[model samples]
Target: MSRRTDNRHRVATICRRATGLTHDTCLRWAADGLITRQRPVPDAGTPQQRAFEARLFAELAAGAVLGLTGIRPARAEPALALHADRAREVLDALLPRLDGTGALRGVPGLRLVPDGGSWWLTDLVDRVARVRLLHPRPGWGPRPGPTARQDGGRDPLWRTHRHALHPAEAALLYGRAKEDGASWDRDLLFSRTLRRLRLIVDAGAQHGWVRLDTTGAYDLVIECCCASGALKLMHGLRQSALAQERDDEGPGYSGDIDVGGACVAVRHASCGSFPQPVAGPDLRWVTC
Candidate 1:
């Protein structure tokens, strides 16, 4: 379905607000191709299109942040794209946790590291565990019994953690031309600018997270809403099939998985999906 959204916020204004950059600076970045010209959405556009714009905003702000940090236009644009691509990968697992108005209700903070780094995105939250309930149907009367498969077990039913990616502990690499042993400029302008951008991102202004009012106008909520809808549809089909199983019926069933916003359907060749289910390894304990 299509909805009408406010289109009056200028791109430069958003950039300025996100990174504290002057309007002129943002315009220069746009002119120099640091900020690619994202397609404009009409007042009434599909939810998906609006969601796309919200995603674009992240790249735009990231580019401006990179540029202001003294990275040249050529390097900044592609770097921003890489960051956005990685962020998009986990959105399907993310969207269900958001509240109706797109505000983050009870999500935890995330820790994200820049690309080409050791920890690009942090591991899943440790406190909680996920399990899938499975029932086996026999030929006689009711199914054999039900079994529980925890996450990482062949396949487990999944639910999202309502966590915000803010207050994120992040580390970004700043490539320097100076020799490894030599002292580099610690107080470079770009270094200062990068720190400022980090603050905005942490506070949820740059990426529009956590806070209620601004979040409705920015990335996480809108993008999450659209993407979450698709994910719900995919899970719904598989869940419905599982809910209707009777003991007299066969052992297998068709299941769907959400991958990059699209549904991929799979079926088992033998009795059913995971007939002889193999349990995954146990979680290893680690101290931070």
Candidate 2:
């Protein structure tokens, strides 16, 4: 079958693996206009239809990860609601900003900040806000808790949850990376969108936390480095993170600084040989 047809068939499988969400949930979210107002993909759909579904699923998955600050869950409705418009805005702004090589042109490393009832995408180093969107439910927070205002009539409380996207995650979710003479793998895009996930799996002879799903990691390596370099970069990423762990407090180090959980996963994987980096390729996508 043509790759496109194959991809259409695999969308459900790939989305399930990537988002840990059933096909029904994603479609329902899409139908409810959570992320986008567009109609969900049909069983037999066009490439555009598949792309739309893939993008929405990816965005939803990212929201789930960032909402919980690196903890990926099977379903996160509240997180999805918090991120819906912002995710759409980010995808809208960044996708076209990518050049022919799937790298953001003249963009800085981006950070997402939740303040008050809005989500802002900002320049990481400068703290300059680039894109902002109001949350679907204003003043939304966890349930059954006292907000600052609720406590003795103090100022309205808002906890800012900020997350930085590794360049790879940004590109995978929003960039248009094409393969030579072949349609890019839309299924790969779904899987790559799930990079924020921390998978606890057994490596060769050991068990530890891995950043990328094992199948997704292999597909990424094969796509970028070919069969010969398969797993070379993945190993390098694990090794590099392990080396960094020794110089710091290791996985136990829990400060505000976050590399999208790359630090924690690598430290945890020190005893094993897995865990890809949060940032995919070290290519210079941004100045920061």
Candidate 3:
């Protein structure tokens, strides 16, 4: 017999938010099917159920919720996807590289260097293909003694950090690129970029990031709300001969670009998507 999917949040799911579990632990659990709730958390599932989840969370807030590693946490993708909607403001600036899917694609006039550059797109597709999870047996909650793998471990975006690509794994994905140092670990650099970009984003109306030295004829701002933003921004500098960056064991595919003696830093989100830039007075060009 089948049952209706309630899509309610659980205690373990709420706890993961405050605890800040490591990415590896999340991945392992996702692989093992530990944190899944009886029903999947809908993107906009139900207001009443969600509010109740919040109330239950408050009730358990005083207890030891963080240490319950056995329970799976709630996924952040639904909220992040919601955030991605606000990122559409910069869609026009990046139109040059967008394809039918609204994803990033190569275009003319911008020569992306660092060879194997196109591979990033290939890698993007590759990573998305890998990394999957098992789902829970809706309405049944946890299985008795774990007869079969069905406890919410299979949800694609099970947790916010569901990405399958990393420097080490990405290296293997690129094979030869790993040997040359072009495809190095980028998570750390990506983290720093995320922080700086968020600073720019949070400082809304200030357009605080655009205090560059160049006084070009035109001012443009580029920022990302999805992964494509970073891809499009980096693609601009790919073919430029003057692009200055560290390719030796560096992510090498992205970084700041210096144009006409002006330094414009290009940054992206750490986990999933990159956002577009915000324009403010005195700031000419901005890209997130």
Candidate that scores best on lDDT: 2
lDDT of 3 at 67: 13
lDDT by residue (102-188, candidate 3, tens digit) is 333221111111212110101132222111111122222112233312223221111211233323333333654345522111222
What TM-score does candidate 3 reach?
A: 0.22
TM-score leader: 2
TM-score for all models, in order of appearance: 0.19, 0.25, 0.22
lDDT of each candidate versus the true structure: 0.26, 0.32, 0.26
Model 1 lDDT at residue 43: 17
Checking candidate 2 for backbone clashes, the offending pairs are none
Alpha-carbon RMSD, candidate 3 = 21.3
Q: Tens digits of per-residue lDDT for model 1 on 113-202? A: 233322222223432211111112222111112322222221111222224222221111122223263121211212222212322233
lDDT of 3: 0.26
Q: Which ten residues in a row have the lowest lDDT in candidate 2?
A: 200-209
lDDT score of model 1? 0.26
Q: Write the per-residue lDDT of candidate 2 for residues 1-288, one digit (tens) a residue.
A: 876444433443333333334666644444344322111121212343324323433433322223321212222111222243233333333222334454432223444455665654344433432334334465643333443222243221122223454454455445455433333354423322332122211122121112332232222211121212224323432322222231243344232111232211222223223333345443233211
